[model samples]
Target: MIDLLEIPGFVLDDEREELLAELRAIPGTAATVLSQDMGGRVQPNVRKTTRLAVSPETRERVKEWLMDAKDVLAARFGVALGDCEDPQFLRYEEGDFFVPHQDGNTPLVHDASRFRRVSTVIFLNERSGEPRQGAYGGGPLVLHGHYRTHPGLRVEAPADPGTLVAFRSETTHEVTPVTHGVRYTIACFFRAADAP
Candidate 1:
């Protein structure tokens, strides 16, 4: 079974808190999915979350941090990675979720996403089974094993604050519905250095 690379404390406590504060202060727009025909479109059934419009300064800072993970991800996944795309600051409240889907490099898509080789998610808060301060309930990130090799295998990613989970862009995964509190994360994609 393929396992996800989990880097604990990928974001330090101070940095995470600062990021959270900045994100909370800004308004958000509905997150969208990339469509093969029309590009990105809001499809609530497939994904339900808010995409924060972070300041350019924040975006650059986050991109730099995400870029720092490229070498590690490339070595772990045995893939050559080039640039890290602008990270998306996402917020998931109660009832929010993303159904099982691949991030990129699939025949179903013919957009810029096709160049994605690695996908990353940085958790900003802890997850609890029940309501608790600075924690969210449910919203487990479930990573599925390749169908041909380990069908039915599902791994729930760790929800520790500042943790980063990296996986192949083609891996099927989903975020289970959040039951309480709020879930915040930064999602980013990495492409090959030679990709057009």
Candidate 2:
């Protein structure tokens, strides 16, 4: 079944960390991260921006890790993982904010080439731990309400460093605006399907 699992202190290798840190430090592209969806409308907030990073040296190692995660998930939960690709680290700059939205709940948002069934986000660094250039709210991940026609539930998750959170892509979630500094995270989407 689909659920949210909190894995404590899931830090990558030194090489992986180096690659991510370097990438996040680079100049962003086209706003870098995608802002949160505001009931199908984008309010446009700076607290949310994704780096969507990758390097030739790091992709392979990350891919292998995801593969291992998929295998482990399947064996433990009896869920068939179709494919996993493109591990990206999302960086949210100061004053940035993402609206409330679910990963796969909206067909309106583009779908993944590979079946994206489950989505995972791992925290790279704590917002408080980072340097605060100017005073601002910490970038906290918030869940507005559950996706249900009849009833809805609220989910709130803070972007704690070294924590890995796995949940169905359909979970309604958002990133709270950061008054100052940046929030770093590693994000990935997973698909489940029959064996090839």
Candidate 3:
């Protein structure tokens, strides 16, 4: 049961396009290659996308939005989350996808990797209210619930521009392959302020 709150008009149309242009200039290999949480290795199979450096002005806006939504998130996820990591902007072109995985912990990996309390993905692209109007095809954020207990339950969060979806980091989720246009997004990971 993931409570995905759709945030309309979070990023204005102009701003989104500006950010997209900045990402397009970077070479895929350099911008997209990032270390995985499991083994600290750069892997594209598990997660593939380029990281966009967010400007300070944009960061301030996001931080304010997060603070304003704290209560809603806390009530929905049943946890007091604080301190969000600097979000990474990601661009997913045709055939790109992220395999199902949890963001919280990975067996023996210590350090700051254990603090991911909440996971967030903010979509950036004009999305028509109609399903067919989606600029890009596929790339739905599929949340895999407990199969046995929550039997046959799955939540699909479409990548619509200006939409924000947040969930517990422990939940298993994946980004389905994009069949059409490129998909742009920002990944935000939050940690509990008081965690050890």
Q: Provide the overall lDDT of each model, using Cα atoms, as 2-decimal numbers.
A: 0.90, 0.60, 0.70
Global Cα lDDT for candidate 3: 0.70
Give the lDDT of residue 152 in candidate 1: 94
Model 3's C-alpha root-mean-square deviation from the true structure amounts to: 3.7
| TM-score, per-candidate, Cα-based | 0.95, 0.73, 0.78
Tens digit per residue, CA lDDT, model 3, 145-168: 765667467889755677778888
- Per-residue lDDT tens digits of candidate 1, residues 86-196? 788999999999999999988888788888999999999888888998789999899999989988999998879999999999999999999999999999999977887
**Regions of candidate 2 where Cα sits further than 4 Å from its true position:** 12-17, 31-47, 75-78, 105-114, 129-137, 149-152
The residue ranges of model 3 lying beyond 4 angstroms of the native Cα positions read 28-39, 54-64, 105-111, 127-134
Better structure of 1 and 3 per TM-score: 1
Relative to the true structure, candidate 2 reaches a TM of: 0.73
| Per-residue lDDT value at 93 in model 1 | 92
Selected candidate, larger TM-score, 1 vs 2: 1
lDDT tens string, model 2, 14-119?
A: 6446755676667754333332221232235422475554666576776666667786565554567777646766667766666766666356766342245677
Task: Kindly state the number of residue pairs that clash in model 3.
Answer: 1
